[model samples]
Target: MQLTRFTDIGLRIVMRLAVAGEQPSDTTPMTTKDLARELAVPYTHVAKVVGRLAEMGAVHSRRGRAGGLAITDLGREAQIGWLARTLEGPGEVVDCEGSQPCPLRSACRLRGALARAQRAFFDSLDEHTVADLVRDPTGAVLLSLSPPPPAPPTDDAPGNRHLPQHR
Candidate 1:
């Protein structure tokens, strides 16, 4: 019943960028590393989530050292409810589907009720945009965010997860 971390990160990415879109702090577009540091998430995670947001048309990105991210018009106007729903996907709330099978698969009014509730949740979220979430007129939200503790160095770099530890 809880939102997935992916959805959470997706929201954070869009909201952070939308807030930053106002020229808070560094006005230039933020790279994944910058976002990861600002949001207190892993760089790999931010990179992956950024790709998802880009695919969803919530943000745009560039490559190379100059590569960075920026929220799009869609991102700024994104509805939290829609973002949650879209990121949550069309899967069943309680896994009442086949193959694995659920005891309630045959007749589950709970599923219908859950669906209705989910719709209502999104309906409420649709009333607000990403901008609505940022109420700080002084842009304190951007300024107040603190960096996370440093990540322990990992030898498991991309495409090298199978590599033997050199240490």
Candidate 2:
């Protein structure tokens, strides 16, 4: 699975705000600077992302000292839903080329099995809400401090393709 850094960061920001809850504490508002510091991301990068998020109405921002960032209801739901789709990739997996179908199409049990696994992957992700990520802010913070998850196995992995034996 290929998750764009944008969606990953977007979800992190949303999760943080959800953990922080609805009130931004006296309207002093949490600035991107504060968020960048907490998230260990560069200030300018977070600012740019925050701009896009604000435009999408996933985050609300104000200008000036008291102005800061907070999550809107729409932003939370939309961001989560968007992540569910894009996190997997911008494309579909089961594609057939030309008029030729895979010879295994008729007898391959693994085809449907893999499809079920793929569906489970998405369904599992969709079950989560931003609220779930915030259930334990400290734990979430600890987890994010670690590196990103390992990349999924590629076609280069062993046994990825069936091969014929040499004569």
Candidate 3:
């Protein structure tokens, strides 16, 4: 079963935040705009996803100068399948009950088969957590997209060279 665009964006947001959280010195929260830019998605789309994630308690958002987005512990430890299901909602894989319903809705074995397939897909995802999505190479790549923390001032700098040593 294919994930909706919303779910896809949601997953990406969580993954990015999870990667950032893993870094001890990367405490700076990411802004929605930053996430949108990094993910190459629309600001509105990212904002909507962020809102949903916040509502679900998977993400935390603060407003103001120090305000930005951060993944909660719940988000970091969230099962992939659970997150997917929450983002995907309770909709069926196929539109078996639409305005113009399928003629074979009553006797379609295909629908049942598709449902099972979808369940299996989610069950597979349940075996992993969001943290599992950003291991090594993937984590490194994601980290590269974030701006590095400011470097500490060195004693060798001209301004600091004349200062008395505290040690």
Listed in order, each prediction's TM-score against the native is 0.80, 0.56, 0.82
lDDT of 3 by residue, 1-167 (tens): 78999999999999999887566877778899989888888899999999999999999999999999989999989999999999999978899889999999999999999989999999999999988887889888888785445579898877888787788
Error of 1 at 127 (Å): 1.1
> What overall lDDT, based on C-alpha atoms, would model 1 receive against the true structure?
0.81
Model 3 clashing residue pairs (backbone): none
Best-matching candidate per TM-score = 3
Candidate 1 residue-wise lDDT, 40-119, digit = tens: 88889888888888988999999887778888899889888988888878876676775787887678788899888878
- What are the clash counts of all predictions, listed in order? 0, 1, 0
Compose the digit string of candidate 2's lDDT tens values, residues 1-167. 44557667777777776555344443456678877777877788788778877877778999986688888887556535555554334444564333887777767777677667766666677776676556665545633443345579887779776666679
> In candidate 3, how many clashes are counted?
0
Report the CA-based lDDT of candidate 2 relative to the real structure: 0.66
Please state the error at residue 82 of candidate 1 in Å.
1.4
Error of 2 at 41 (Å): 0.7
lDDT of 3 at 11: 97
Runs in model 1 with CA error above 4 Å?
Answer: 21-25, 137-139, 149-167
